[model samples]
Target: MIEGLEPWAQQGLGAATGLAIGLLVGLERGFKLRRQKEGKRVAGVRTFSLLGLGAGLAGVVAETQPIAAAVILLAMLGYLAIAYAPRLTSGGDATSPVAAAVTVVAAFLAGLGNVGLAGAAAAILVFILALKDEIHQFVDRLEERDIHAIARYGIIALAVLPFLPNEEMGPYGAWNPTKLWWVVIIVTGFSFAGYVANRLFGARHGTIATALIGGAYSSTAVTQSLAQRLGQTKGGGAEPAGIALASAVMYLRVIVLVAILANRILLPFVILLAPALIVAWVAGWWLYRQAEPSDAPAPPGNPIALVPALGFVVFIAIAAVAARWAQGQFGEQGIAILLFLMGSMDVDASIVTAGGLPPDLIGAELAAIAIGGTIIANMAVKIGVTLAYARRNGWSAALALLASTLVLAGSIAVAWLRL
Candidate 1:
């Protein structure tokens, strides 16, 4: 907005922005000290406003006389130190003084013509100050495991990711170390997020809600969890519907991941997968209505185990090599078979493998079939998981998933004919 403005106008605008930022901080401070005796208060809205204005004027002079600006800031800080000395002696908290210091810095930045940064900093400071109690309460709720999980993720994302090379290496140049690690990061991140949500909000709702949240990351894990709950309760009927709902969410989640990492094949993939997605939801809804109410499924284990994360990277690396080999050896047919087999255990690995390939290596139709086949195989695996974990009590969950799989199969067939 200031792009075409004259120099004097820009300076004027900067000064105004600084004053506004100061007024905003001062208002919060004033509210906190509203009950204090007027004469005893060290700072107020008017004082802050004047400080902002003075700082802004000093900044204008700094463009031609930088030493003057430094002197002005030092003099202001000196006054603040003298005024706050009594509070320090009385052992009062330093929040107010620290806030005052921030206000000065932010206004100085605004005066230096960084109005956007100054405004943003001032707003965030106010927000943090306002939420002090809530933030403390949230911190109090953090378990040791939660803190460890946070630190682990920080390492995975911030420490490790940036250091990995982006170039494709290994056999057939099929594996890009950076891309493979990113898959692990994204998949692990999703699972960890679901774990956190389930911990915080799962018990408050019930099995269905837990399924909904868990399904976004790993429907298979959700199935196993709910199936175990069903076993303990001997046909706690809600587990079946919850399992189905998680699978439904999985379909949507798959499409979303596809959209994020590989959009070229998205249209055909969605077309073939849409019917299954709808069927899963419809079947889940029906089963949910028929089942008796049940408690929330037990929380799943933390999904961030380092060994498993490293193992997944290995699997993705293998899948990428195998996919490239299959495409070369048997064309689309070989790749389709490879994808189906891989998807039975881990659909995400197949996705990463396929997404990493050159776009022209497989047309959209074949990509849809390969990914759709994985979904079908994954559903079949979940059905087996239900029966294996829940025994006879899991028939409802098995039936619901079977219906969706049948629908998905039919959709795949239709898509095949069009090819």
Candidate 2:
């Protein structure tokens, strides 16, 4: 198509690109201003279209006479300021001319070889304008603590992270401050998302919804929380179902993390873990079906507070050092044992350590064994915590959880035997 066009037509095509983008934006603005008194709108479709055309023409002139193009742009800006000067002085229409100013600049850029950027900015601006009500509502719902939590996350991820040294610092060169902080960021970010979701929807949706959302952050925490609720309610069967569902979600979460960080070992890990996930899901679903309906309050507060994020960073660093030392001293078997011990406390830290290990020291087979051990150990911890905390009414839930774990164990045994 370009080959068929004359040189003048080719240049016209470039100008047309700017014109089309301007028209798209102008059309949206025109619709928005449709109900406004005709003269009240600062600029609508026709005004914006002409502005875009002038900008494009200026850009074409810039190729041969840059100074002339500059003057033309300045003239346009001057005209816009004069046009809105009365409104600015009146103070009745406090609406700033910033958006219109930006649109003109975008139009200039669209002509000056930045059409994509101009178009994207215009589109995003339109979207923000359209979502004004929703944005306001979201802000209105945010509590002081929620704002603080967001600031804390920003400090950790943005302020503190970049200053951390990237070089390995301690314990067999296992601790890289930058890398460790990044892991903290990823984990904390994930937990923050779940925390936000629970806040937004958990009250209306109840136990099952809370379980699923909270599970993404820390299934162990969810399990313990739900178990405590069970004790309070005198063995509400639905609480057990929520616990089981959270556990099931944990397995899938591990699979995703492994696939992302240690993809080569994912198949074996999934083979050993997926059956357990399936068993837990089935048990949870059955329990949900058997239970009476009840409201499960939203889990309290953001789980990714600053102190907890720091604690997790310390925990993960310790786990990584321990796994590295163990691997060096007793090889893969040592790693397996350390991972299981660590997993009993925090499966995420254990799995992350296993995934970060050098492939030579921990091949697919060893990583799989270590990961499997951690998972089984974590399951035991969950069961024990439930039984211990919910002592009065958790017996039935513990039994159900134990049964699921046993079924998972059987599947793992079968997998190992086949191997």
Candidate 3:
């Protein structure tokens, strides 16, 4: 936007933006300190506004005089340090002084025509300041494992993901290191988000809420967990309801992953899977209504399971290579067969593989059918797990899933007919 403006106009706009940034942060700070005595507060809206105005004008000058800009920044920093000296020596909170310095820097950036960055920084600063108490309370609730999980996620996402090569390699040139790792990151990130949400709300919201959240990452795992809980006791209807609800969430997760990684198949995939999704949810809600309230089941394990994530990347690579070979050997039909077989064990891997395939190798309709088969196969596995592990106690869940599976099969058949 600024690029089209004359230099004088751009400078005026930049100065105005800087003033707005300052006002935003200053308002928040002033509100927080409203109860304090006037002299006790180091800075307020007026002081901050002047500081921003001075910084913006300095930035305008800096376009031609770099040293002048540096001197202006240093002078502001020096003033802040001196103003905050008594607070520092008294061991009081130093956040205000630091915030003041940041405000000056953001205003300067704005004046330099980096309006986006400056605006974003100022907004974030105000948000952090406003949420001080809530943020601290949240920090207090975090456990050591939770902290470690965060760090692990950071390593994989921020540290490891960027550095990986993006070139295709391995058999049939199927594997791209960055793409595979990205799948891992997406899966793990979902799991982490679910885990954190479960920790925050599962206890108060009861079994159904837990099921919904848990399903975000691994519905199979959620199923097994709830099934085991049921097997141990007479179990309330909520347990079966939770199990069904988690399965419903599985459909939601799959549909989302398909949309993100393989949008070509999304329409057919959703059409084929929507019946099962609806059936599962309806059954779950019915069962939950009949059941008495029960304790929320224990949440899942670690958020970012690094070892499993690495293993998943390897599996995706194998599936991708195997899918390519299958396409070569028997054309599109062979690729469908490959996806169905691989998806029985890992639907996500199959989705990623299908997404990476050449556009001509298989049409979207056929790809969706192949993935639908995998979904059915995966549902069968979960049903078997429920039966084997939960035994008679799991009959309600098994039956609900059975109904969905039947509906899903019928949908696939109808889709096949349309083709």
Best by lDDT: 3
- lDDT, candidate 2, 327-351, per-residue tens: 7799877887787777667777776
**Candidate 3 lowest-lDDT run of ten:** 300-309
Best-to-worst ranking by TM-score: 3, 1, 2
Q: lDDT rank, highest first?
A: 3, 1, 2
True lDDT of residue 123, candidate 2: 78
Instruction: Put down candidate 3 lDDT per residue, 128-160, tens digits, no spaces.
Output: 999999889779888899999999898888889
Q: Judged by lDDT against the true structure, how good is candidate 1? A: 0.84
Instruction: Give residue 291's lDDT in candidate 2 (0 to 100).
Output: 77
**Candidate 3 has which clashing residue pairs, if any?**
none
lDDT of every model, 2 decimals = 0.84, 0.76, 0.87
The TM-score values for the models, in the order shown, are 0.85, 0.82, 0.93
Residue-wise lDDT of candidate 1 within 243-312, one digit each (tens)? 9999999999899888876688889899899988999999999999998887796766677777788888
Q: Tell me which of candidates 1 and 2 scores higher on lDDT.
A: 1
Where model 3 places Cα greater than 4 Å from the true spot, the runs are 388-392
